[model samples]
Target: MAGQDDERGHDERGQDDERGEGDERGQGASAPATWRRFARERVAQRRFAARQLAELRGYAGRGLVAGTVAVHLVAGLAPVAFMLGTGLALRDLGSDAAIGWLALAAGAFLVQQLVAPVQLVLSRRVQRRVDAACIERLATFSLRGASLAGLERPEVADRLSQADEAFEQWTLTPGAAVEGALALTARYTQLVGSLVVLTWAAGPWAALAGALVAIIARLGQTEAFHRWGDVIRSLAPLRRRANYVRELATGTRAAKEIRTLGLVDWLDDRYVAENRAVLDTLWTRRRAVYGAPFVAYTVAALIGSVIGLLVVARADVDVAAVSVAVQALILCGRFGVIFPESDVKLVYGRGAWQALLELEDIARRTGPEPAAAAPGARLTPQRSVRLDDVRFGYTTDRAVLDGLDLDLPVGTSTALIGVNGAGKTTLVKLLTGMYTPQSGAVRIDGEDLRTLDVDAWQAAFAITFQDYLRYELPLRENVAMAAIAHRDDDEGIRAELERVGLGSLLAELPDGLDTPLTRALPGGRDLSGGQWQRLALARALFAVRHGASVLVLDEPTAQLDARGEAEFYDTFLELTRGVTSLVISHRFSTVRRADRIVVLDGGRVTEAGTHDELVATGGQYARMFDVQARRFADEAGAGSPDEPDDPFDHSAAAGAGATGGAR
Candidate 1:
C-alpha cells in the first residue's frame, strides 16, 4: 500500500512538471467555517486598522487636512446662507433697493464658485495621503517577519489580497465620507439659514415641515444600504468559487498543463458554472435587498416633496422664495442616498482591514528570519556527527527511520546503500537539522543540536538532495548559491564551474557568467537533464570549495550518463579529501570503492563492511549483485565477444567505472 502511494506521488510530480515555476502570486479560497472563525478572531485587527485611519490623519499632521476640513464645512454652509441672503436681497429690491439685491446675489454666487474647486482639490489630496499611509502600514506590518510557508496558506493569501483591495476601498470611502458629511451638513445648514429667512417671509410651521422631510428621507436610505451589505456577505461561497475559477484559468503555473491536457474546455465550463452560481445568488438577493429600499425611498421622497408644496401653497410664497425652498428639499433628498452608501463602504473597508490585521498576527507567530551565513573556515572535523538511537516518522502510522544508530568517523566517506523504502533521504534531513529526531540526538562536537541555533547548525554541512532545486537564475548564481555568502569570490566560483564540466557551457552563453539559465526567462536557454545534473553537482562542489565539512549526496547523480557519473564520483572523492561524507545511492557499482558500505532495510542497518568483504560474505549486497550480473553473463554467452553487438563491454566500465542500474 505504501509503495503504491509512493508511485502515485511520483506520477503526480511528473505530470506537474509541465507547470511554469516562478514567484507565485495569487489568492486561495478558505472553507466556509474557516472564514467564519477568521472573521471572529480578526475583530481586534479590524479595530486596530480602523484606528490607523485616524493615525493616517495624524501623519498628515493636522496642518493641511485639518484646516481643510474646517474650510470645507464653512464652504458647504455658504451656499445655503447665500440662498437665504438672496431672498432677503430680493425683498429689499422689491422695496426699491436694486443695487443691494444685485450685490447680494453676485457675492453669494462668487463665494460658492471659488470655494467649490478649492474644497474639491483639497479633499482629493487628503484621500490620496490617507490611502497611501494605510497601504504602506499594512504591507510593513504583514511582511515584518513572515515565513515562506505562511505565504502559501489559503487564509493568509486571501487576507493579503483583501488588504490590497481594501486600500482602494479606503480611498473611495474617505472621499465619500468627506463629501457625504458635507452633504448632510449642508442640508441642516440650509435649513437653519432658510428657516430664519422664511420666518420673516412665511411662518415657523413651514420651516418645521421642511426639516421633517430631510431627516426622514436620510433614515430610509441608511436602512437600504445596510441590507445590501448583508446580502453580499451571504454570497461569500459563490464569490470564493468564482475567484478560484479565475485563478485556475489565469495562474502561470497552471497554464501550460491546462492547455496541454486539453483541460481548457473543462476549465472554461467550470468557470462559467461558478460564475453563473454567483450571479444567480447575487440576482436573487439583490431584488430582496434593493426592492424594499427602493420602494421606501420613493415613498419618502414623494412625501417630502408633497409637504414642501403644501407649505409653499399655504404661505403663498413668491417665485424666488419657492425656488430656494424647492432646491433645499431636492439637495436633502440626494444626501439620504449618499450617507448610507458611505456607511456600506465603511463596513466592507473595515472587514478587509481586519483581515490584514489577522495576517500580521499570524506572521508574528510563524515567520522565520532569513539567516545570515556566519563566517567559518574550511570545516575540518572538530568532532564526528553522532546518532544515538534516533527515531523519526513523517506521520503517526509509518515510521521511516526508527531507533537508528550510526556514526561516521572523522575524515571518512561512508556509503549508505538501501532498498527503495529504506528512508535514506529522511536520514539525510535528520542529520542536517532540517528535521529533529523523535527519540534520540544528532549531535556535533558534544553540543546538543537543538541547543545550537538552527541557522548555525545547518551551516555545518552542504548537501545535494535527490530532489535538487532547478533555480531559474543566471548560470553563475545557480552554481554560486551553494556558497551565497562568497559574493565576491569570482575566482573560486569559476574554478568550481570548470571542475563540474560546466565551464564550456558557461563560455557558450551569450553573456557568459551573467546569462540566465532558464527558458522561462528572456535571453535564456534551458539545459538538458544531464547538463542540469552537472550544474547541480557544481553547486554542491561550490559548497565543498567554500569549506563544507560534511557532504550528504542523496541519489545525486541519478540523471548523469555513464562517463558523467564516473567523472562526478571521481571529482567528489577528490573534493572531499579532508572532510567527512555520507553518500546514499541505489547504484551499487558506485559504492564498491567506498571505505565502508552500510546496507539499510526497513530503517535498520542489516549489513556493514568493506565492499570486498561484503561480496565474500555473499549477503544482501552480494545476492543483489549476482541477480544483476547473472543477466549480463547469460547475454555475454549468447553473443560473440569480438563483435560490435557484444553484450558485455567491460572495457567501457574499466574506462569510466561500471555504470548501470542497482535498483
Candidate 2:
C-alpha cells in the first residue's frame, strides 16, 4: 500500500511538470510580442535623448559646440599618444631616436595637462548659454496660452515643478547635459584609441576580448543609471511636496503664521517626515539599482586585467611592447568606470530636458484656439459690452456662473453689487478676456468676443481689482506701468496721482516720482494701506488718460475710511464721466452714486435699475440694503456720542441718507 502511495505521488509530480511546460508553450506567442514592445520603448528613449542633445547643442551655438568638441577630442587622444611615444622611447633606448621619442612623450603629457583646463572653460561657457536659453524657452512655453485656464491645470504645475528642479544645485540642467555629452564623447573616443593601441601591442583576439569586457561593463552601469533615473522621476511629486513643506517652514511669506500659530514644531516635523520618506525610498532604490553593477563590474575588471597581463607576459614581446600593452589596458579600464560628469549628469539632465519637452507639447495642445479675427483688429466698443447666457466654472462639478446675462452700456457707470461668491469677479474676468465662458458669448459692440483680438480688447480697459498689485518700483513706474507708452510722461503721472488725491504723498516722497515704493530698496518708502489704494487708483486713472476707454473698479475703496471712501467716490464719478465704468462693491453707500446698480445672485443678474428704483422695488437689493442700514444704525447707536465717529465705520448716516436718495 505504501509503495502504491509513493508511486501515485511520483505520477502527480510528473503531471505537474508537464502542466508547467504546457503553460510555457501556451504563452510562447506573447514572448515575441513582449520583446517587440521593449525594443520600441528602447528606440523611443534613445530618440528622445538624441533630441535633447540636439537642443543643447543648438542652445550652445555651433561655434562654441565645435570648439568644445575639438578640445575634448584632443584631450581624449593625449593619453594614447603619451603611451605610444613612451613605448617608442623605450624601444629606441641608447639610440639617437630615443631623445626624439622622449620629446614626443613630453609633448603629449603637456597636451593632456593643458587640454583639461581649456575644456573646462569651454564647457562653462556652453553651460551659461544653455541655462539662459532654457530659462527663456520655459517662460515662452509657460505663457503660450492666452487664457489662464491652461496654466492652472495641476499637470502643468507639476511639469513646471520638474523643469524648475533641473536648475537646482547638483541637479542636471540643460547646460550640464551639453557639457556631459561633450565629456561622454571624449570618454568614448579615448576608449576607441585605447582599443586600437591594445590591438597593435597584443593581438586582435586579445583586443576583442578586452573590448567585449569593456562594453559589457559599460552596459551594466548604463542600465543601473537608467533605473536610478526612473526612481528619481517616480519620486518627483513626493519631492515637490517635500520642497513645499520646506519652503513653508523657511520662507518669509509664512514666517509670521508659523511663529504666531506655534506651528514651527509642527511644520518642522511634517517637513522632516516628508524628506525622510523621500531619502528612505531613494536609498533603498539606489542600493538595489547600483549594487549588482558595482560588484559585477569590479570582479569583471579584475579578471579582465589579470587575463590581459598574462597574455602580454606569455607573448614574445619586448619590454616596450609590454609597457604599451599595460598602459592601453589601464586606459581601457576607464571605459568601464562611472564618470559623474558624463554618465550621471547626462542621464539625469536628459530626464529634465524630456520633461520640458513634454510640458511644451502639453502647452501647445491645450493652448487657446487661433484668433478668429485678424491680429491687428482692435475692439473699440461703440454700443456696449454684453454677456449673453454665459456659463463658466473653475471645475466641472459645479458652475460659478450659470446662464448669466448682463450688459454694460457704453459711456455709463454700472455698479455690480453682490454677496461673496456671487460670481462678481468671474464676470469681470470674462469681460477682460482673462477667461472664456464655457458656453454662451461675450459681445463687444455686437461682435462675438471670441472673434475679436483678446489683447486689443483687454488693452481698452483700465481696471483696479480689490487685490491690486503694489509694485515695488519707482512711483513713476508704479503708475505708468498701466500704460507703458506713457512711462516717459512724468507730468501725466503726477497729474493722475493728484486726481487720485496722492499729490501730497508724492511731494512727501524723498525722490518724488523717482522714489521706490518699498523699503527694501535704497531711499525707498513704504505707504499706508490708504496710500496704496490711492496709488492703485492713480494707475487706473493713468491708463484712462492714455486711451483706455473703460474703467472697472472692484472694491476699489476697501482700504479707505468711510469719509475717504465717500470723498473718493464723488471724485471718481466726476473723473470717470463719459468713460464706460463698471464698479463692483459690497458698500451700498458708495455704489449708490452710480447711474445703474445691478445685483448679482445665483450667477445671474437678479436686480437691475437705479439704486433708488431697486430700493423702492422691495426685492433682494432692497432687503440687503435695509439689512446693512439697520446694522450700521445699531453700531452708531451703541457708540458713545462723546467719542467721535470711527473713521473706518460703515456710517449709519450714509446708509440712512442713501435709502432716501439724499446724495
Candidate 3:
C-alpha cells in the first residue's frame, strides 16, 4: 500500500513537471523571476480581457453596448455627485440655496435607482448575444478541419475537452468575461472618482495616500484570485472524471450495463471520491493562497481608514467639508475591497477565453490548407485506387500498416479478409484519405492523392463502417444525410430505402418518411438492430445514387442473422453492381462471392486470388475458409440426422463463428 501511494505521488509530480512547476511544495523559481513572470502574465491577461470586451461589443451591437455603458457610468458616478451636492447643502443650511442643493442630491439618488434595473436588463441582453455568438463560433471552428487525421490527435481532444468544460462546467463563458469587463470598468471609474473627490475636499497628499492604500489592497486580492484560478484549472482532469462518473449514473445509455453488472454503488463511490479529492485540494489551496493576503489587506485597509478619519476629525474643517471627506474615504475603501462580480469573472472568464483562443489556434494549425490545384477539381477514376508501399501508424512505436501495397480496380468488387488487428480498418481509412501515410503514397488513377483536392476526392466514396452512427432524426433526414444535395427528392430517398429492404419499416411509420428513428421523441419509434443496419445501407446507397462511385462496406451486416445477412449481401451486390466496392467482413461465406479476395497479415497483403484458385493453393485464405467450413459442418452434424442440412449453403453459414480464422 505504501508503494502504491509512492507511485501515485511520483505520477502527480510528473504531471506537475510537465506543467513546468517544481513540486507540490512550490520550490522552483527564484523570487525575482517569479515576480517578473507574474507581471508578464498580468499584462497578457489585460490584453486578453480587452480582446474579449471588444468581441462582446461586436456581438452585442453598438446600441446595446452603449446603453449598458451609459447605465453603469451613471450608477458609478452618482455617489460622488450626491456627496458633492450634500456638502453644498450643508454649507448653506438656512438659505433657499441649500434647498436647491438638497434637491440636486435627491435627484442624483433617484437617477441611480431608476438606472440600476436598466443596467441589469442591458447587461443580460449583451450576455445572451455574446453567448450565442461564442457557441456558434465554437461549432464552426470544430468543423473547420477538412481531414479527420488532426481531430484524431490526443492534443486536439484535450483542447476540445477544455473548451467544453469552460463553456459548460465553469460557467466562465466569453459572455461572462465581457460583462465582467464592463462592470470592472465602472468599478475603476468609481474608485478614481472617489479619489478625485477626496483631493478636492481634503488635499492632494491625503488623496495620494488613499490611492496608494487602495492599489496595494487591490494588488494583493488580484494575486490571490490568480492563484485560485490556477488551482481551478489544475483540477480540470479530476472534474472531468467526476462528470463522466455522474453521466454514467444518470444517462440512459449506460443504465442497463450498470444495473446488470451491479455497479451502481461502485459508481456512486467513485463519483464521491473524485469530487471529494477535488474539493479537499481546492480548500487547501484556497487557504494557502488567500489566507495571508486577506488578513494583510483587511489590516491595511483598517489602518488607512482609521488614519484618514482621525486626520479629518482633528482638522478645524466646516461641517460640509468634513461630511464630504468622510464619505469619500469610506467609498474609496469599499471600492478597494475585492468585488466578486468583477474579480471572479475577470480571472476565470479570462481562462475560458484563453481556452477558446487555443482551440482557434489548433483549428488554424491543423485544418487543411488550400491545395495547389483548385478545390473543385473532380476525381474521375478510370484505373484503380492504389496504395503504394504505404507506411503509417497512430504512433511511432509501431506501424499499423507498414510497406503495404494494394489496389481496388474500378468497376470491380474486392473482398478484404484479415484477423481482428490486421489493419483492415486502417487500410480503409488510408484509402479514403482520412489519414495520410507517413512514408509512401495513396494514388488514384496514378495521381498522388495529396495532389488532388481532398474534399472532392473524399466526397466521391460512400463508406459504411463497422460502428455506424445511428442518427436519431427523421427517416428522410437520416437517409438523405449522405446525399444532402438531393434531400428534397423524397421519392428517391424512398426508393433507396425500399432497395435496402426497409420498405416495410417505412410503410409502418405513421408519419412515413418524417418519423424520427428514436423513442426519445414523442410519436417516434426505434428500429430493430437489423432494421438500423438496413437504414445505414440505404444511407450509403443514397450517396452512391448521387455520383459516389466507390462503395466501401466494413462489416455492414454485423447485426443481422445468418439468413438476413445472406439476403442483405445478395441485395448489396446487386445494388452496387457497377460501383468499385471494397467489402470488409469476417464471414467467409459472404466473401466467397466477391470477384477477388485479398488476405491481409502482418500489415501487408500475403495472398490475393479468386476463391477457388486460393483454395487450390491452400494459403491463408484457403485455411480460413476451411476453418469456417468445418465449423458449419460440425453444426450441421449436431442437428438431427434426418434433417440432412447442407453446411455449404450461404444462408445457413452466413453468421458462422466470426473468430474462426480471424482471431
Candidate 4:
C-alpha cells in the first residue's frame, strides 16, 4: 500500500510538471521579468471594461441607460443628503432656523430610504437585459472562427477559461460594471460634499486628509485583492485535480470501475488530502494578504479620529460645525474601507473580464477575417482531399501526427484503423478542417485549403465522433442539428432516420419525431447505446441530404456490442452510398468490408488496400486483423457470416458444451 502511494505521488509530481510547463515557459526567459506585464494587464483590464460598456450601450439602448442612471442619480445623493441635514441641524442649533434645519434633515433621510428601493428595482431590470446580451456576445465571439484550432492554443484556452469564470462569478458582466460605475459616482459625489463641509468647518488640511485617506485605502484594497486572485489562479490545477478525484468516487460512470478495482479507499483518501491541501493553502494565503490591510485600516481609522478631535478642540471652529465635520469624516471612512467578501468578488471578476478581452484580441490578431469571403465561399473537393506532410502536436514535446500524408479521393469510403495514440482522430480532425496542420497543406481539388473559407469548408462534411454528445432535445431537432442550414426538413429527417435503421427506435419513442432525448426533461426518454448510434448516423445522413459531400464516422461503434456493430456495418454502407465517407474504427470486423483499409502507425500511413488485398499482403493490417479475429473465433465461434449470435458472447459456447456432454 505504501509502495502504491509512493508510485501515485511520483506520478502526480510528473503530471504537475507537465501541466505547469505552459506557465513556466513564459517565466523561464529572462529570470521572471513581471513589472511590464502587470502594467500591461492593468491597461488591458481598463480596455475590457470599456468594451463591456460599449456592449452594454448596444444591448440596453440609450434610453434604458439614461433612465437607469437618472434613478441612480437620485439614489447616489444619499451621502450628500445626510451631510446637508446634519450640517443644517447643527449650525442653526437654537432658533426657528434650527427647526427648519431639523425638518430638512428628516426630509433628506426619508428621500434616501424611498429612492434606494426604486434604484434597486430599476437596476435589476437593466441588469437582466445587459447580462443576457453580454453572455450572448461572448458565446458569439467564441464561435467566430468555426475551427477547433483556436481551442488548441494554450493562450486561447486560458482566455476561454477566464471568460467562463467571469460569467459564472459575475465579476465582469456589463450589468455589474454599470452598477459599479453608478456606485462609484455616488460615493465620489458624497466625498465632494464631505470635503466642502470639512474645509468650511476646519481648513484645507482636514478636507485634503479625507480625500487622501480614501484614495490610499481604495488603492491598497485593490492591490491586496489582486494578490489574492493570483494565489487562487496558481492553485487552479490543484482544484481541478481534486474535483477529478471527487468525480471518480461519486460519479455514476465510475461506479463499476470503483467496485471492480477496489479504488474507493484510495479515491476517498486522495479526495480528503486534496481538499485539506486546498483549505490549508487558502487560509495561509488569506492570512498573508489580509494581515497588512487590517493594520492599515486600523491606523487610518485612528488617525481620522484624532484629526476630528483636534478640529473639535479648535476655538475658531464652532462646536456645531465641528460636529458636522466629524460626521463627514466618519462617512469617508465607511466609503473608503473595502469588505473582503464582496470587494474580492469584484477583483476576480475584473481579472476574468480582462482575460476574455485579451483572448478576443489574440484571436482577432491571429485569425483575421480574409478579404476574399473565405468564410462564405465553398471549395468542393471533387477530385480529392490531401494532407501533404502534415505535422501537429498538443504540446511541444510530443507530436501526435508528424509529417503524415494521406489522400481521400471523392466518392470513396476509406476505413482508417490504428491503435490508440496512432493519430486516427487527429487525421480526421485535420481532414474535416477542424484543425490546420503546422507544416502541411490540406488541399482540396488541388487548391490550398487555407485559401477557402474555413466555415464554408466545414459545411462540406458530416461527422459523428465516438464520444458523440446526447443533447437533451427533441428527436427531430437532434437529427436536424446536422443540417442546421435546412433544419425545417421534417420529411428529410424521417427519411434519413429510416435509412440509418432508426425506424423501429422512433416508433418506440412516445412522441415520434418530437420525443425528447434525455430523462432529465419532462416527457423525455433516453435510448440504448445502439439506438443512439443509429440516431447519430441519421444526423450525418441528414447533413448529406442537405448538401454535405462527405461523411466521417470516427470509431462510432466503440461503445456497441458485437451484434450491434455487425448490424451497423450492414446498414452503414447502404445509408452512405456515393457520399465520400471515412470510417475510423479499431475493430477489424466492419473495417474488412470497406472499399479500402488504410493502416496508420507512428503518425503515418503504413499500408492501404482492400481487406482481401491487405490480408493477402500479410502486412501490418493483416497482423492486426488476425489477432482480433482469433479472439472471436476461439471463444464463441460466432464471427463468420453464417453465425447468427454475438461473436464476443460466450453463451453459445457454454450451450454447445452442455449439449455435447448430454449426448
Q: Please name the candidate that would achieve the greatest TM-score relative to the true structure.
A: 3
TM-score of each: 0.62, 0.86, 0.88, 0.81
Candidate 2, TM-score vs. the true structure?
0.86
Q: How many backbone clashes does every candidate have?
A: 0, 0, 0, 2
lDDT of each: 0.65, 0.79, 0.77, 0.69
lDDT of 4 by residue, 1-663 (tens): 112233334446546654555465666734343444445455554454455455545566677777767766665566566666677677777778878877777777888889777767766666667667767767866775424666556676665666675677664554565555544545566677787877777787777776666655665666676678778766655666676688778766688888899988888888999998888999999998888775786577568656655654663777677777787777666655764323644555545544555556556555434323343344467888888999987767888888888888888899988777888888888786667777788898877777777677777888999888777899988999887766678889889888767778778888888889888778899988877887887888888887788889987766655555656676677767888889887766667667888888888888999988998999887777666655555554543455535433323321121101000
Q: Candidate order by TM-score, highest to lowest?
A: 3, 2, 4, 1
Candidate 2 all-Cα RMSD: 9.8
Per lDDT, the best of the predicted structures is 2
Residue 215: error of model 2 in Å?
2.1
lDDT of 3: 0.77
lDDT value, candidate 4, whole model:
0.69
lDDT of 4 at 286: 91
lDDT by residue for model 3 (15-55), tens = 55546534322766677766655566566555544655675
Write the residue-wise lDDT of candidate 2 on 184-244 in tens digits: 7678777898889888888776677678667767866776787788798778878888999
TM-score-best of 1 and 3: 3
